[model samples]
Target: MARLKIADNLDGEPQTAEELAVKTHTNAPLLFRLLRALAGLGLVRADEEKRFHLTPLGRTMRTKGDGAFGDFMEMFLGDQFLPWTKYVDAIRTGKTQFDQLYGVPYYEHLKKNPDERGRFVNGLKQMTKIFNANITDYYDFTPFKHIVDIAGSDGTFLINILKNVPHARGTVFDEEPSIEAAKKNVLDYPNVKDRLDFVAGSFFTDPIPAGGDCYTMKSALDFEDELAIQILKNIRNKMKSGTKFLVIQTVVPDTDEFHIGKLFDQYLFMLTGGKERTKAEAEHVLRGTGFELNRIIPTTYPLWDILEATAV
Candidate 1:
């Protein structure tokens, strides 16, 4: 599905199986079978000439320029796809097979491989593009003087927020490589540039940067439970008792009807050894870390929930 979607965008038309196979570097026969299956599912349609075209669903996967589609495909298909062979073993051992397959943990693998790191970062940016607007809409930023985005990669989300809230200053804290990218991104906005500071260090080891009235962590808690708590605790320790902490992440719905959260939970579990939490689960985590859940703000869009909490 991903390959066909990308190829359809690249070629600007529905391509035949031969064209798809050559573009995707797969066998033509297998490509034909896959396309046929997709057509049957109404994802794509085949013309009388046997050329395939994207259905409405298929067009949703198409991307413009160097967009989410390519980055998302690279992250899932190229890097994370290999570890699925060991899923049965992972289930048996109750451990991630990614470590066994790559001989390192997921984050470690990303740190060591620049190409993979680039792809992962780009994919994250793509994801942020989808969610940043929702975040800007559903949350209130008027009360904040300065906002610190913890674990903020490339500052894309912060940039969007800062662009809208003129009086609100921004700070982005992340690893050195990501901070460097954020610096480049902030160059255009001189007004926000003076207000924006890019700090490089592990949030676990370093003091959370001060001077921000509000702090945010986007989809960051799911990365590691202990680390996430520690970050919240660290932020709580520095806050003046009124600082607001916003956690923007997918709030897993309790029901089992197919939703993006369900799929993302499995993806996190399989690839990153992380798990998405429900609203109650989030409340538990926040309360355990010396904060109280203010509310779980649902967006007009899907798969995103804003958990607003404050230090006790």
Candidate 2:
């Protein structure tokens, strides 16, 4: 639907497969079959005349605009989806199958492929819209005058934070691609535009920018344990004592009750050799990394929680 721009073409109006095909430049017969399947999925309604009307649920698949997940769906269902094919192998070897299949880490592959990188970045941006909603309301960010987002992709999270905490300034420390995206995205929020700065570098090698009373790593530390600990140590070495480190990620629960993080844990391992940590697991990593786990604050979003730590 996203690839053919079906949702965008439908625009809440009923149209025959031929009409949709004309707009999407697809085969009418095949398009009709696709539309029929979509109707079965409740993404569209097929009338007696065989015309298709885009359902409200289907409108979310539009490639752009508010509440769209077209790119997000495309990313997960496209290249990223390939990693899951090696799930069994990954479990047997306890390795990131994506690295084996692609001959590099996922991020490295993205850097080498511009088209896939764009899709991945855009997909994360869309995901931020879904998962990071009203995060500021849940967490008190006003206490910190300066916040540094480590490996903050596209600065969307920092932009949102700065918007809520007007008195605070933010720095997004990430790679060149992400910094470039951040530059363009910050323009949309004129209120926080001037206060937001972009620093292009890898968190693994580059010295973390200093003077931030609070440092945040959102969806960043879902890597191998050694790497995650190294990142924490790096931040600890650079920042002053009494500063806070906020790890915005999911904490898998021990219970059988359903949690999205459990599902994400498998995908993280498949793609990056990472696992979504449970509370105890999260604290274990934070311990002896020059920080003390202060609290775990849950936000409205189920997949993200803020593990607040203090630099001792």
Best by lDDT: 2
Question: What TM-score quantifies how close candidate 1 is to the native fold?
Answer: 0.85
C-alpha TM-scores of all predictions: 0.85, 0.95
Clashing pairs in 1: none
The numbered model that scores best in TM-score is 2
Q: Candidate 1 on 1-312: residue-level lDDT in tens?
A: 654454454345777888777777788888889889978987788999889887666554554443335456656766788888888887888777788888888888988899888878876776667678556687879778899999888888888788779888888999999999999988887767877888887776687888788899887568668767877777777677778888888888798777788778877877878888988888888899888899888876565678888878
Candidate 1 residue 121 Cα shift, in angstroms, is 1.7
Worst 10 residues of 1 by lDDT: 59-68
| Candidate 2 lDDT tens digits, 1-312 | 987789988976789999889989999999999998998899999889988998889988988888898887877865688888888888888888889988999878988898888888777778778656577877889999999999888888888889889999999999987888889989999999999988888888788988999999986458788988888888888889899999988888989999999998888888778889888888888886888899988877777888899998
